[model samples]
Target chain A: MNTCKRIRQHLELADFMAEDSFSLAIEQHLATCAECRRFQSEMLQLKHLLKTEQRVSAPADFELRLQIQIRRVRAEQRTVWLPWIPTPALSALAVVVVCTVVLSVYTSIPGPTGISQDPTAAHKPTPNSGPVQLVQPKPLKPEPAEGLSLVMAATGSTEPQNRPSPRSNRQHDLNPDKVLVLVRDQNNTENFVTVPTVIFGAQPVINTNAPRTEPADDAQHIF
Target chain B: MSIALSYGIELNLERTIPIESASDHELVAATKEGDELAFQEIVRRYRNPITNFVFRMLNDYDRAVELAQETFLRIYANSGRYEATFSFSTYIYRIATNLAISELRQRKRRQLFSIFTPWKTAPESPEDEQMLDLPDTRPLQDEDLIDRERRLALSKAIKTLPEKYRAALVLRDVEGISYENIAQILDISEGTVKSRINRARNMLREKLQAYL
Candidate 1:
């Protein structure tokens, strides 16, 4: 190899020169060529200076200062709005609290005054005449079977008790074999009425202990 | 990782393993578990090396120390996210390098701004002139002064290099880190690290030829 090329290789691998044949050739070249030898020496000096450059030691109070700063930062992190709960979890908790408060308030407050005073007001018929009244079909003749009479009596008592009473004189007209009667109000509202059949000789008498009223104000038509 | 417990109570638990003997990843794991001593050990281990690396990069001792402190603070804060995929040294050095680069960019911006602003000079009063005329009684040595000047010039030359080349060269030559480790630290390939170091060394040699 030429002196310059060998010198360049020597400079590059100066630390790894272990007397190999190639390195020996570079050494021989360096011995003869003064310029290459100078280059090699400068490269070695540069490497030595770089390796020995003074390293700056950390300040004496570095550890103490760093620890204090870390403590301060961690303190700041801990002082968040809700320390134990994460942001999303805290938000969810807030939502739950609001919803529970709303529901409790809604349930604790009393309902409308009229409905609160009379719980059955919803089932009672109103004084207003505009609402349509649905009438159940009346049985033509009450069955004489005891079971049928008991069933009719149980079902009839469950209706609203605000219906006008039937006339006392009309009780005699009911058939003796039929123990129950179908009564219609003056508003054409049909209702079931249970009556006991009284057998006076061959005729049946319904002894209804109701007070009769005038036909205009209160009238119940028995069908 | 380092919890700030209430009432200012600091625990000084005895270490199971010496800080020097434990691997960096193991220490990092201990730090993640809220071991205060482990975090202290990490800071003790890397503080000097990081300070030197940043000092060479910025050529400002005070700023370099400040940035080195910030590097450890970042490591402590982000310890929970630390994975054991790479060496802890690589991770911490990467943090230091990034902070140093950011500081350099800020310095460049300030320099640019100063260039546009008008230079304000205070007129020298009689008192200031009298202070400047004070005599120098201390003897000066030529050899020490020349050595100091050369070192100063060398530092200036390294500062003039582009940030990438300077980092590679300092990490490889001064810090004695292997090319593979430097690659992991800088997030670059080993070949790129080698090329940058060689180029940086050549540039420095040219600049400091008179000292050589």
Candidate 2:
């Protein structure tokens, strides 16, 4: 850097009150450069003006007031501990307050659907009357026959339709002697057991419209 | 006779310094041991300077006095934590500066609160206007009048600077604190202190060119 710039920086940055802060180099530069000299003079004047500022003193009763407050504080405080005494406690209290506020705010705002806040809510058994049942499928809707024929013919958009529903297949259950009994096997899987049509306790027709299948439970004897 | 250890305890020596002549750190050490006299000496020595410093920052006599008391009470209450690593003056000044700055911010917040909720308080005061203002109507000589006006302009210009720059400038120039102690007092680097003071001075010069 040039001497003038260097000297100006020194003038700007150095303590104006400190004698000998300026080196011979700055002095020589300032002597040669009038612009730097002017800048230095203005800065000195400004610093001097700032330094000579009129100070205002505390009121006459400041000490008396302070002493009274101090006496009261001494009387109230149980101990004269270090400055760090209250900082840790205050910070911990702040953390607890912030956490509670955040938790309450989070709970108040609506959450996404189907998710239970209490994890155990899903695990608790629901109260339902009468019998516990798995979700039941919708019943099949009847379609209109085109010509109302005695000989059964396909009806309603018959473009190689999907296989008849499990209920539809048993519509023509010709086996009056055997009935397809709905049974849960030992492994807890649903399987239809073809048992003889017998009135033990008279359940309605055993939903004979249900799909027909051979008996899978070897342990049970078919009547 | 070389004597400086008599303030806190009875030093068995040929001669000892008076309590009035004890160093600040020695006074602090004595205060730590529950010497109310030593602590009172500290308060007596610092009260005006601390009060004046806060007054310069806040430009309010009442709050400055109040906060200066708080600063001392804090020093007294926390005397055990006082370390001689930095000077007692720097520590005390730091407390006063923090209090003043916090008051300024709180005043600003209150002003904003009044602005947004005017019904909660009086009508909205201008942002730059002083709070709890007290005016002097006494007449002055021409020279004194000019000087007072200039000082007011200077104070106004100082107030206009941002908090960091204002603090560094006031501590360095008005209080005549050394840059090193200012760095400690403001919890900033010396370079940062210098930069802020430089910027603050330049800004003030721009605003107070006529007064200068």
Clashes per prediction?
0, 1
lDDT of each: 0.66, 0.66
Candidate 1 per-residue C-alpha lDDT over A1-223 given as tens digits, one digit per residue, 9 for 90 to 100: 4759756755654432333544566778778888776766666666767787889999999998898899898788888636746679989999999999999988876553211223222234344411211122223344333211211211123232323233222222222223343444334443445443323433222223444343222223222
**How would you encode candidate 2's per-residue C-alpha lDDT over A62-136 as one tens digit per residue?**
778878998888766646445435788978988999999999988876453212334223223444211111112
Model 2 regions lying over 4 Å from their true place: A1-7, A17-38, A78-223, B1-17, B114-141
Tens digits of lDDT, candidate 1, B42-76: 88899999999999999889999999999999999
Judged by DockQ, which candidate is best? 2
lDDT for each residue of candidate 2 in B73-185, tens digit (9 for 90 to 100): 89988888887788989989999889989999998798687677645554345533543343344445698876777677677777767888888888988998989999999
Listed per prediction, chain B TM-scores read 0.80, 0.82
What TM-score does candidate 2 reach?
Answer: 0.57
C-alpha lDDT of residue A22 in model 1? 46
